[model samples]
Target: MSAWLRRLRPGRRTWLRLGRDAAILLVVYAAVSLWQTRHLASGSAPALAAHAIDGSPVSLDALHGRPVLVMFWGTWCPICRTELSTLQALSRDWAVVTVAMDSGDAAKIRAFMRERHLDFTVIADPQGAMSRRWGVVAVPAGFVIGPAGQIRFRLVGLTSSWGLRARLWLARGGF
Candidate 1:
């Protein structure tokens, strides 16, 4: 031990170990995230022909010539709530449509959205049929589709606004 270090109680190694462990945990989390997204397709996204909460017909097939962000969420999901503001902001610039799964009827969803001040386009999927078709088993799932209707990036869990924006940029053919 160094002479100056010997003057104090000797537990400096424990602090080092804690930092090392935290770093390892972060690495493991990143590895798992990469593994989960490793094989997600860059090919065509699944068909999404449905009705919006406003009783208007909505179809992903019609959006083939533009990039779109498809989000799967529920009002009851906390993580979904966290991403809504980011999504709302993105909608003004990017084409974003969210499927509200298990969020009750149009009236209930409308009330919820009004309370939250969310103005993004929402398609209600109370029966979960459409969500299943998209292979979404969790809330707050997001897919960035390219101009050619190709699935470019998939996001699961609480994705940061910057991250989503970056992927949106990528979908727009930006580096």
Candidate 2:
């Protein structure tokens, strides 16, 4: 074997290594994208419904005159817990609604709320019908709906404080 060839590690060719890494990354990316897109397409607003923690039915009318933050979450999701806390802290100035995808178990949802000490209005969507309506395949998804009933902003994952602030600023109608 040539000295140069002997010097090369068995599988250390740059092009080959890059191609393999790229392929793996592309596959993972495609899978996540496909999952998110499918969930998005399957979910829509107005098709799901839920009752508040107090057993009162929550409707769009409740938010008719206000900008609403729709947060979809579950007790099992760590990110949901972190995001929920962040949201609750910043949401004092805004009307926020939470939908628990726990499916019919008001008890579980309530326990989660109590444990987290979250004070926002929480509705139970035990069947995931509401989740589907909101295109929430992943936990910790959020939607900011304007007073006009249109989606002003949508966040699909763990959001930074800066990002949340930016959205809030935009909602307040700034440049």
Candidate 3:
């Protein structure tokens, strides 16, 4: 073997340590991430029927021809606040509705939305009943529902706007 190749090879001890650290990191990451998403429904969304904060009736069964973004958010959650922009941007091309989990009553949510300049549709989950029904345990959790009423993807963290748009596009068979 070439001297350079021999020099580049790590010693057995170094390799073992590196492998151990990597394995540990992987396990830790999996545990944390699973905690965030393990409770979310995987294939299809649940029967959702409620009134929007604006008093509009919201039923997922009625939105059959367009992809819907079901977002779970809390006013006090920093991650949810930060991810709101992505949701707003995606609202332009898709059906985006957020469930305000424990954010307060309709009046409070209206004021918060006005203050934040968030124009997307919102459903009030003042008691978190809707969120619990949706199987959402984490703030900022997102579920992409296809036009045919199937959940195409589930996002448990701060997902990018482009990632959401791409999922919507693919769900529409835009490929």
Candidate 4:
């Protein structure tokens, strides 16, 4: 083989190595995501009935005819902060009920919401009782509950607005 053809062999090998590395990385990511959400609620969602920080009644059962996004987040979680805007936007068009997992008392959460100009309904889980009940071990956990009250999807960590919107749409029987 000529020198030019011989040099091309290493380039082909490099591409193969890059592809293998990418595949491995993707597998690792899938494994970690699965492990992180292993204990999360599934099938029929747990009963959630509580008063919002504004003293309004918020019940998952009330939203039984439509898909609802139930999010577990915290004021102290930086990643959750980044997702707050996405949640606020989603709340405008969909049912979004967020639990402030160990964030603080109702007053503190209200203040945080006010500072962020966020109007999404928040249920303060100061003692993490709600989080524990939902099997949420970390912040930024999201669950899409279908109209029949079944959990349609569960996501952990930071999720894009489009990603969340798609999940809610899917839960609503949208293709």
Worst 10 residues of 2 by lDDT: 40-49
Model 1 TM-score relative to the real fold = 0.80
Q: Write the per-residue lDDT of candidate 2 for residues 1-175, one digit (tens) a residue.
A: 8989976856558778899999999999778756564555322345334578878777766667566677788877788877877778766877778888864588777787788787777888788777876667788887766666666777667887677767756755657
Clash pairs for candidate 3: none
* Model 3 regions lying over 4 Å from their true place: 1-35
Model 3 steric clash total = 0
Model 3 lDDT per residue over 25-85, tens place: 9999888877788888878789888899899998998888988888899998999899888
RMSD over all Cα atoms, model 2:
6.6
lDDT of 1 by residue, 33-78 (tens): 7766554444789889888888888898888877899999999999
- Which window of 10 residues has the lowest lDDT sum in candidate 3? 33-42
Which residue pairs clash within candidate 2? 43-132, 44-133, 103-126, 104-126
- Give lDDT for model 1: 0.85
Which of the numbered candidates is closest to the native, going by highest lDDT?
A: 4
Q: Using lDDT as the measure, name the better of candidate 1 and candidate 4.
A: 4
lDDT of 4 by residue, 1-175 (tens): 8998988777877999999999999999999989999989899999999999999999998899999999999999999999999998999999999999998899999999999999999999999999999999988999999999999999999999999999999999998
- What is the Å distance of residue 113 in model 3 from its true position? 0.5
Number of residue pairs clashing in candidate 2, backbone atoms closer than 3 angstroms, sequence gap of 3 or more or interchain: 4
Model 4 segments more than 4 A misplaced: 1-23
Q: In model 3, state the lDDT of residue 81.
A: 92
**Candidate number of the best TM-score:** 4
